[model samples]
Target: MVNERDPDAGTEHWLDLGPDPDLDSDPRHPGGWRWWSLLVAAMAVAALLLTQNQRATHPLPGTDPAGASVTRSASVAARPLPESHSPPRRTGSPLSGQSLSGMLFGASPAPTAVEPAGAQASAVSVTDLGHPLLAVPAGWELFGQGPGIVVRIELGRGRVTRTSVPEVGSASPIFFVVGHDRAIVHPMDSVPGYVVRDGKPATQLPPALDQAASALPGPDPWHLWAETETGTATALSLLTLDGRPAGVQVPIPKDATVQASDRAGNVLMFGIGGMYDLRQDGMHRITGGTLLAVGPTRWLTLECDESYRCDSVVIDRATGARQTVKASLDAYEQNAGAISPDGRTAALLQPNGIGASTVHLLDLSTGADRLTGVTTSSDQTLGGRTFVWSPDSRWLFVTNGAGRVLAIDRAGRAISLDVHVGAIDQLALRTTRR
Candidate 1:
């Protein structure tokens, strides 16, 4: 009945209901006890844990948190805040009374700043290859005589190397006699004139009225001349090493002295006999005669006797201008002169009016240069003819025209033992001749 809800149209069935009270019944019920006992046990356990923690240890000084203590930890260690109190401004005139506090006690040492080993940075350095090792630097192994006709000893790494000079244009089968390394046969011009390398002829020009009284091998940039007869009065001549005809040939009156082809590709003809004019290259009536390499980029014209020998005239190759560039020696002649492969330096001959010879180098950079005595005389009959400049520039091999191949330094000092000329460690060059 209690489970039924009153309504004008009532419903009866109900389920899942709790007991409902009625006013007319009497009953007795028992209550569960001892609930407070569990609570008391919990409090006792917490108290024991607190006591153990406190008695365990009192951490030495700073080890314990600033104010983190058994009792006052919350008040002392809890983050301390900045005060709103402002400092008092300074006033002038004072009877300076700085009060001292009670007996100052011990204080903790300030932490060391530990000055940083200020970071050190690194640096760089590079050797400039200027003048051919012109003065042996240090640490160079001389393999052998460099490029030429017979076997030329090479001095360099891998495939890049330097060797001996092969006989280019000559009479007979003048070879690179292992003995005659520095000496070139007196007359390089052929009678029926043809350019020959090794024993073979490379090019041939008709015989001319006049052949160079003497010949000088080219500088680094080789300067060459050939005289071939076009007819009786006029002869065909060229300034280049290879071409069907010379780049240019101007008419000459039967005789001309010095002929030169500069790097600019211009042909020049001049004579230093007694009184002369530039017979070619349009440099008409220029004084002085024999042209010699005076600098890396300059040439020298020496005023000599009718034989055409004098102090060399140095001219700048770039502008084809003239300046007297003299070697320290009083008198000398060029059996051979070479501009260093480095192009920044050069090698030359300082001949003793007799047979001995010396070597020198012209430094293009500092304008400072030097000369060193390289050899005594070389007779192919006795020795041979050839002296090759080492590619490193540090040494020059007095290898040819002498019985022995000696190594001379840039300053003209003897560095290596003299090696007899041979094929042991040399490069072979075969000049083409027909």
Candidate 2:
């Protein structure tokens, strides 16, 4: 009802329901409504916050992150691994210097020493023996008792112990000649090839005896040019020991030299021109003039049945069997041959060539332990004169037709001597290998 103000300016309005009601007593006041609304809104906010916190604390199942590896907290399934492909090592081979590597390793192995059949005994000194028999290698080489004497096979010569060769032309006929070690002294074509045991002048043989002594094929093998009045000189017998038979007759061409007896008698003579091996009781025909003694074994004058270059054969002594093996000379040298004490190797003795005459040895599969030369000398005669090994394999006696008696100790060194008598036809060392 009052004067109307400008329309742009609105008039403030306030309504008063009651004059001064006690606000604490009032239940439905405008202020009350506002306070109730705030309380309800704050409670709603708190509830919503709690729900969000719970969700953030833990994510729901069935949801996994991308690119996660499958990690195993425990052991994995059994399967072949590349690292396990290695072979298990041998117990002995590991420490045998075979080049095996592992965290756990051991020591190297030792060699096997296979000695001959005799009961092991200490050897005797050469000085103890009276007669100035040829000296020899000591130890396992030769066993001595009354002295290392080459017992004379003939009763007449048996009493003659002194190795003193009579004056040249004195006519003390010498039926036996031996080369002590590599030294040769004998009465052959008679030129007096007498070398003493002390390197002194023993005596002299006739020119014929000298010629015969000098004619020996030095260190290579027994090469007797083959001359005979009967049967075309079929076989050349070896005279190893003083007491041995003249020698085993090695049949020529039709009957080859099958068994080579030692020059001194019986030392080592087996499997030469041998037949039948691998298969039992077998036999083969040996060519005539086909077999000849080379060195330890037989050197073939003829080729194998197949016409191959073969020189080695294994003989079954009981069955008289033979088996021919074709291989290089070195093969024989390393396996079959035993090196002499003086240092001359069987290999050096026999070089492969046309018309080569040589001597060789063939030990059973036991393998060869070669002897190394002590001194440096090329002359086979000066070094190893092919001292024959005794059948007993116990002694190594030296024979130089000149009469310097030498002995060999299979376990020690070879000794030199100044003594003599009839030239040694051949000599042998005793065998221990049974």
Evaluated at residue 156, the lDDT of candidate 1 is 26
Which stretches of model 2 miss by more than 4 angstroms?
Answer: 1-307, 323-327, 330-362, 367-369, 374-386, 398-434
The lDDT of each candidate is 0.37, 0.32
Q: Report the alpha-carbon TM-score of model 1 versus the true structure.
A: 0.39
Which stretch of 10 consecutive residues in model 2 shows the poorest summed lDDT?
Answer: 139-148
TM-score, prediction 2: 0.30
User: For residues 233-321, what per-residue lDDT tens digits would candidate 1 score against the true structure?
Assistant: 54324433332343555555566643432322233454444223222454454345544433234454456577745554554555767
Ten contiguous residues with the weakest lDDT in model 1: 77-86
